[model samples]
Target: MAPRPPQQKVVTLTDPKAIRALAHPARQRVIDELYGGSVLTATEAARLCGLTPSAMSYHLRALEKWGIVVRDEAGEDARERPWRAAAKDLRIDHSGHGAATTAATRAFAATFVAPLVEELLAWAGSDRRGQLDGTSMSRGRMWLTTEEAKALVDQVVALMAPYEERTAADHPEGAAQFSSFWSLMRRPEGSAAD
Candidate 1:
């Protein structure tokens, strides 16, 4: 049978609390697993993250409280229910929300990018270039009006959103999960943070 199309959707987070809650690394591990279409029990997630099952269960409950993950039906065992990612994507849009929201969004962005950065560091320190073939680093500089930047970003997101939601089973043979990170910033007069 042919692979199915992605069930593309995004849950946009504006609540500062939710954004902060999701900044936890353990929770992100669960999100990544679920994003790859693996419905997991807390124990399974714990195993994947090298945490105790009880600790993992606590993290799962926290995510469930925020509606970031939902419980699926029990499989063969009546006691172990699986969890699924609430949506294909979880996005942060705290702009214009004030200081707390801004801080939470900053933390979320850092948390989201940290693991990918570690992967880059790993590649840099390793000699597994052949094993990691097709991995790449890209850089580009562009000058565009604010409106044009927003439009371009929206277009890119729209184009990739569907692909981002594809499940492990939806991929071809020998497929692996690929991590990606991108940032767009304008050149600032004095501040490099821009």
Candidate 2:
């Protein structure tokens, strides 16, 4: 399963600075690992992301400043503790307007959404997709009032909440990690909600 918030706290970020900080490709990769059940020290994360320890420390600090990640409790000797994702889910609210914000928002979208698209394309072209039993590719649109849309998203979130607390070891046999992304967005030529 994809990363789910342990406490069902899906952080909605409207701060451009925070978004910008998170949009770095290496930082986003590190965040994915942390969220996906890796509690990593700076050195470990650096090795995972192909950065030097100091450079990883810089990225980790930027994420820490935004509360996107936090250091776990220290060892007995006060060595650099491992870091974990502060939230399982992150939503970027791109309601801000400005050139810098626009750039940041674009970068954020690329970092998060590109992998989904790439994975889907690869799956579609491969024989493995035919062997899979539970893969899902769903897309549809509805004319929902804004309030109704919010309610729909809430229901979906609630559906996911129970899975949040499960660990890899707790998973049943034959279970595999899944990657998915969902979005509800208006079409560019969309009319006002009915």
Candidate 3:
């Protein structure tokens, strides 16, 4: 037998129910556990997330139904089935969905985004935060043609590809997770309704 790859390439979510299901804190933890191609049984996941096994099982089942997680066929057991994330990362596009879905997406985003803000604040307050850590953040406005904006995003993703493909074996020591967030949107001003 051979080993599976370290990660699945990607999974995109457009279904509102799936997005809403993922919005819950506990389920988000479950998804995080399975990131980077890791697999875990409900019991193991529950322990990590501080949830009861049954509660974790319920969340896993919901994720499974949404195709966000799947039974780890190689590790499946009659006693306790294991699961893995369907992709190394998820891409969500709800622009095609209606207002309710947009609202749900906002709520889902807050679940993760708010924590990132707090984490940044905590790090900034701590002595361990070093100026040379390569962490950078910024906000600015740009005037660009639609084509130009698309090209900018493509360049950003290209720059991130190598880092995103890394595995623990690549570093072998002191490896850690890093996060980045970006969005490019047109201002609501000057629109017809406005």
What lDDT, from 0 to 1, does candidate 1 have? 0.78
lDDT of 2 by residue, 56-166 (tens): 999999998988888876655467877888877767887788887898888888887766777889888988887757788888779788899889888987887666545
TM-score per prediction, in order, is: 0.82, 0.83, 0.80
In the predicted model 3, the residue pairs found to clash are none
Per-residue C-alpha lDDT of model 3 across residues 70-183, encoded as one tens digit per residue:
877545356887787787667776676598788779889888677578778988898868766667778878888889988997797778777765654454377677666777
**RMSD versus native structure for model 2:** 3.7
lDDT of 3 at 66: 79
Candidate 2 wrong stretches, greater than 4 Å: 1-8, 76-78, 190-194
TM-score-superior candidate, 2 or 3: 2
What lDDT is reached at residue 188 by model 2? 61
Strongest candidate by TM-score: 2
User: On residues 70-169, what C-alpha lDDT tens digit does candidate 1 reach at each position?
Assistant: 8776778879887887777767665656888888878887888878888988888888755747788888778799899999988988887766766766
Among residues 3 or more apart in sequence or in different chains, the pairs in candidate 1 whose N, CA or C atoms overlap within 3 Å are none
**How close to the true structure is residue 148 of candidate 3, measured as C-alpha lDDT?**
99
Clashing pairs in 2: none
Candidate 2 Cα deviation (angstroms), residue 112: 1.6
lDDT (C-alpha, whole model) for all candidates = 0.78, 0.78, 0.76
